[model samples]
Target: MKTIKILLPIFIYILLVDLSYAQSKQNKKQSLIKPVVEPPIEVERTTPNNPDQYQLRLIMENDAFGGFSDRYYTNGSRLEFHMSAGESNPTRKVFSYWNDLFITPNEKTRYLQGFAVGQEFYTPTNIKKADVSYGDRPYSSRGYFTNSLTTFTEDTSITTELELGMIGPSVGGKSAQINFHNFIGSPTPQGWDTQIPDSYSVALKTDIRKFYHRFFGTQYNVNLGNIQTDVSFGLIFRFGNVDKTPGPGSSALQPGSPILHEDGKGYWYFYVNPGGTLQAYNATIQGQMGSDKAYKSQNRSSAFSNWDSFLNNPTPDVGEKELQYRMLSEDNGKNTLQRYILFNEFLVNGTTNPYNIGLNYLIFNNIFNGAEEIERTTRLFLLSNLSAQWDQIPTNARALAIYSIFRPEGGKLPPIVRYYSYEVLSQFILDPKQRETLLQLLREEAEYRDNKTYIADLKRAVGFIRAGFVSVSNAGFLFGLHYNYQTIDFQAAKGLPQQHQWVGFQLGKVF
Candidate 1:
């Protein structure tokens, strides 16, 4: 009885252990059969296609002058002004403002509102009477009476430009833009004369935006109008963080240095523009003044006097005559000899980031004349530009070449006149150490070219570098010098001192 009892307890214990083992196997099998529940699938968010934003821009410029005048009188000195002519050297001020507003209420649509205004005026200053003459006539005479010929001449002018437009929905990843802008108002001419007629102008432009894949390129724009007709292509590159805004305009990355952004991240782009235009101009008024026989005869003597003296003279017959002569000559008896001009340009912009390069070639033919003459008068232009940002060496360089042939069927001079020009430039940004090295290189080059004809009739080379610090933004400024040279070979004078040379500094923006 005792043995049986012990054997029964042992059998029960074995059965319990077997039961526990079976349950553990069942749980493991169930775990293997169960399905996985992964976290929700992730999706990327994209920027909406709506346009709404505001933009403002301002530009300021100043220039200094020092050169010998063709008339033998000193070019004189004056306070620096923007780019007005008569305000030369005299202190001049200019203000320009541009504002843009964008509104978008739906996807793939946008509207633009823009306004621009500019004002420029010269402070009154003393003036002096100067002599001026015209043509080869030496009969005209005039004089200015004043205290040291110093009189205050003040001129102020303003201009306003406005635009309103809409952009259509993007197609095939490309957008279309159509806009109308009105250019109205009177602005002073470049010189001190400050004389320009008020005029109204309207322009229409159409282009495909972001035509190529993001990296490959942008669009080509076509413009048509009385002022100009041309086509241009742009190369685009971007950098920095992008904003998730409606429309491309507002989404432009903010301006900054050492930009940061990832692939698919919104960024800013810089585009280089290469374009050409066929332009026409009819200075009927000036041409008439140049060819008017009566006006020329009346002002014959005054035409030889200094420009200032002749301008102040009460009986300015020469002025009337010159105006009439120009008018008649331009009319060419048929009432007009339609004048035409052609221009080509290569533009480099790093405003966005990762500078770009572009090149353009243009031809302007005087089609107003017969085909044979047109072939002879054709003008050609070639322009190229480069922009790049490397470690401490950010640089922009440009080259231009222009060739023109002027032919007068009935003039006493040669049947054809040829004019040619070539220019090269480089603008650089350097750290302090790099700047010193660059300056030294420049000095060495200048010394090598000194007293040598680097260019035709070019005798000397001069350069200036300016550095300054401002308190507001603590902005540091560094600007290099302007260099220019000109050489002319006059064919009419033959052996009579027909060669002229001009070399000087132009103080202003580098690009």
Candidate 2:
């Protein structure tokens, strides 16, 4: 158990030095002068009132760890704690003169302190839709608490954080997502009672890195408020056993981190962290930024059309850079979320002094911009109900290309995406009663053929892999078992053949 809590105090100080050397050899019986033994003197807890040391981490994210079906950017979790970056910054009591004008403490900075609490939830893509699926990616959730401070030097590092949160449905996201899917029996999302309500959230994040060696570097991140605002830049490649430079190895396990041993000696490594971002706002995909209450007690007016249900009750904060290209479509990457994130780690560790243990293998690939904002509210609910009759709207694309030969391209099916793409709505809706009233509103609109998924090659997506196998103990615990995969962000005209796998797991500890 954490190596007997760090070797039970050096095994009770070597049994009190062997009972004071058998009472001084029976009172110096023939004093054969010989006595020399000294060990057990360690120090380097530079302030933070000599924290002595501490660590704890617990993180989780899911798509069921890539089992192949759940919903968009599903579950997420967090629990973190740390100590001893020591040089100063034990919560900088009253920002000691404005945090020393940005941490200048010498002896190669390291100032650390972090505290966290988390929760994130989102679903759609059939969490057994009970209401409002209109264009998927609705039911939201968020719950947070954070406070951080870090200052690394020996390259460069500067972390900063401050957050307190709430997003909707009191962040329960439907009873922690249906009591964890009835304890893993799956199926029970019922749309968090049409989520994304509550309010009061705050944010402020910052990350900066500089490095030039220990495997190259460069990074910059920013987050503002109202739940999310953005800016980013990235790169930070590390080869195996890296980090003698860089900073924060307190086993934060990014692409697998596990370093820190002042005698308990133990090591191992491998990491790759690529990144990207430009999102401007994302209160769970464009809701609740100014005046939000996601429709107060839920009434997305059943995706609209009871002769115009309250003029489209609660639904009109579109995104993806405000899309408007109507009549049949394309984004090649859908909603252009398009951020590139990848992580590959490999660890193998074991220590004793300050306790540490390990085992790792994580390969995470993330391609976003697909299901965010469900293709901009399915083209603003089809340009607000076919714009008062075809000023140029007849988009049934030949019965969705003859209902795409009975669906099944859940991935890899973009040869100009056809299945008889109905020759441009039969050569311009050749009036047969306006092409059968836009082909019966494109077979009951079904979120416009699930946002008429498209990806005419632009270097692929609909993919969001998440490989796994993690285990680290004592020295900042963490457990994992991923295997996520994604491709079909949306597309269900009643042919749910899976395209969002899951099988994720993670448990952590240290302290």
Candidate 3:
């Protein structure tokens, strides 16, 4: 009985072991033969037929659009073509690669490309003045070409742009303004002669936005380049109905297709983009890149008693060179040109060369300043004669400074005061008879006196833009108006307007 029991237990144990091993082998074989699967992943593919169309947009902006205004922000016009790269297009891959390199995107985002050619021109409040209005932005203009890419998804979008252009007389700002002004019988600008100098310009720009409910959103934009650089962040408010997200079709993007949510249905809305721009550089307001200027003019013989006198001087009427001799009253001291190069250097993070203007100054003593106006003029005459034989004349700081600001003509110092400053004049100046002759000349000049004197220092400029702008859109047409209570742009004197009003119009149609 014991043996039977032991054999039965061993047989049962063997059978059990065999069965377990066979089951393990079967499971292993099955695992080897079958492929392991990951959780089913959702693949995203672009919707078909979304490309649909291309468009051309004409954007126009001007101070005139605001009416009764023909000054600052004078005119801007651009023609741009925009087209979406359909999912299957070759351009789509190009855009995708470009986007991958610069901006963010997802598989669901749509892409578009834009190309444009444009011009922008600005002037001081007094465009009629044929000189740099010392306190206002000098005449400035730019002509440029731009290439941009945009990636959008539903209510969010990002855009990156590259602009290549030039700023200067070559931009045709003066001619364009003149033609437009003539057509409208408006005051024509005559001071483009001192416009921003010719310089190559390049800039990169990016815009990021998020909109909700199709009525409001926020925008952040940044521009960096030789032409314009700024960071702008603001809120956008819409007061009408459009069945689509305001961003993708927003004209603010590259010339966009009309926000046609439903075919044949017109969409109209008025939007306000209340924003603040932390402006850093503007080539138009400040001088252009590179040298502040190639050459500068100095007071010649300084014979003229007044600007009119300089104009009437028998000096050869050379073109701009002669004109520069009397242009921007940058000659605040009325004797030497004071450069804003240092101030500009601090303002612009660009390369620039300061002018090497050798000092040809007439220094005088402070005592000459305490004296009455009559004595001041007489003593200056004395010093000029004394220095007639020397390379430079030394006078006290106060006397020379006092004499510098007052126009020679305002004191009736007469052009003769300088003309007689030849070496021969020194020999006779000390003689009693010669002194009386000079005194008599001064006395006669007193008859031609006026009240005006030194011009105020040129206003230091900073880049800034703070304003409220309104935009209206209807059936692909856009119009904008800006009422800005300005910042100090460039003022050399007091009393220039501190506020400006202008208009903007952007109209586009798919061609």
Candidate 4:
């Protein structure tokens, strides 16, 4: 009975041991067959398209500083086209192929990086002609009598600009940009010595913005080539997708399209002017008229005395009296030909009262096409000039008299003053072809005045000729109007009439 009990215990122990071993093996097999469960991972939802990679822009602007004018508060106008390129986001990897090329993605870099290029042209108005040779004209020793005889002048300026820049990431909602603008100033062909030879300028521009992805911003400008600096602001509107998020899927392992978005639309605008000009200089005529003795002392030349005597003793037969009279005038400070006045004579009608005058000037411009894209501008001016008294010759009349020329009519009636018409053409003819012909005619007239024969006749007929006494006294009162047009864009056919005037920014001492 003892042996049977020990054997049974031993067998039971062995069976328990075997069962525990099998159970452990079964657990191990189960572990191998069932996959391990990992902790949950977060998957961020991303947009379908990446950010914009390229941008194009059109710009128009006006600046009061750094213009053609030497006066304060003058403005220049500009038109421009621009483009830029850069990596929208370098951190986000959109394709695996570039990975093989070893362009590592940097997750920390989240801003746009790029470079830009632009071309522009600027036109500066309200500038003065500083050169004495071209603009100066001389006449009469009565210095107080004629301001136009010394100072009637204009300047022409056109500048072409090329720009380059590096674009930086947005800060405080404003995109940062560092730009270099280079430009050259060209002189007007018709104007004398208006060209500033070998002249080019450069400007550094810094910008910051935030409106529809940099639509509004403040600009700080510095003229690197000159002593000019400016600060201005601008606004722009953008109409297109402006996001830069990588899409879902295994784009990280495959190639993808680089273009972020389709076409975009935007327009930028800005204006910068210091202020309207103020009246500062002593009025020329006012200063001269302060004393009668000073005026008479200044006008005591023999020529002046003779002209005065003749004007006071005019008779009907005086128109028939022929004598040589030199047509001379003071230019800046020296003597020069009265070309401008003579030109004006060919186009304007004048009266003894300097303020009473009528004038017209027209320009037909074909900027692009010869005839199809022709444009036109007309300028009309009228002024009043009144001095106390002047002598005149007997009025001569001929049925077929050319307006500027007079034929002798034998008659001596009385001493009298006369108003004269210096009309080159009786009425303006507006035909396009005729206008071209008119320009040629004007050139011819200028040549005619240069001819020796014409000059001799003018000298001999001075007192007798109706337009002979070209006197400018009290020349300040002037009224003028201009009509202008230009074509901006051919594709959109955009254009409008722009109004301009010779008078602006009356500040004295520009330097």
**What lDDT does each candidate get?**
0.21, 0.44, 0.48, 0.19
Q: Residue 367 of model 3: what lDDT?
A: 11
Better of 3 and 4 by TM-score: 3
Give all TM-scores, in the order shown: 0.23, 0.29, 0.55, 0.23
In model 3, state the lDDT of residue 135.
Answer: 50
Scored by lDDT, model 2 comes in at: 0.44
Q: Judged by lDDT against the true structure, how good is candidate 3?
A: 0.48
Among all windows of 10 consecutive residues in model 3, the one with the lowest summed lDDT is 363-372
User: Where in model 2 is the C-alpha error above 4 Å?
Assistant: 1-58, 66-73, 77-87, 94-112, 115-121, 125-161, 164-286, 292-511
Candidate 4's TM-score reads: 0.23
Ranking by lDDT: 3, 2, 1, 4
* Residue lDDT tens for model 1, 1-511: 1222323344345435534654675467567663685433212113332212223322221122223222111111111111111111111111122101111112332222222222221110111101011111111101110000011111111111111111111110010000100121212111111111122223333333332333333433344432223453433333222232111211000000011112233333332222222223211111111222212222222111222233343454655644433332221111112322111111123222223222212111211111112222223212222122223222211212122133322111111110011011112222345434444444443343222210011112212111111110112111112222222211111112222222222111100
Better of 1 and 3 by lDDT: 3
lDDT of 4 by residue, 1-511 (tens): 1222323344345435534654675466567663666423212112222222222211112222223222111121111111111222221122222221322334321222212222211111211122112111111001000000000001100111212211111010010000111122322211111111111223332222223232222211112212112332222222222222121000100001111122232111221211111112111111111222111112111221133233355555543321211121112212222423442453233423222222121100000000011011111111111111111211331111222112111111011101112112222322345445434444443343222110000011100000000111122111111111111110110111122211211100100
Better of 1 and 2 by TM-score: 2
lDDT by residue (1-511, candidate 3, tens digit) is 1222323344345435534664675467567663665433223222342434466666666667657456666666666666654444443455456455544566656666666677777776665444334355567778777666677766666666677778887777777777778898775566666576778889877777767767787777778998777776767677665544543333332223222221244455566665556667776766664553522222211211232233333434444433432332233222222322322222122322111111112211111111113335654665555445333332332233334335332122332333232212222223455444544544443333212111112223333232333232433444433333234444433345655555555555543
Higher lDDT: candidate 1 or 4?
1
Query: Is candidate 2 or 3 superior in TM-score?
Result: 3
Maximum-TM-score candidate: 3
Candidate maximizing lDDT: 3
Candidate 2 vs 4: which has more lDDT: 2
- Arranged by TM-score with the best first, the candidates are 3, 2, 1, 4
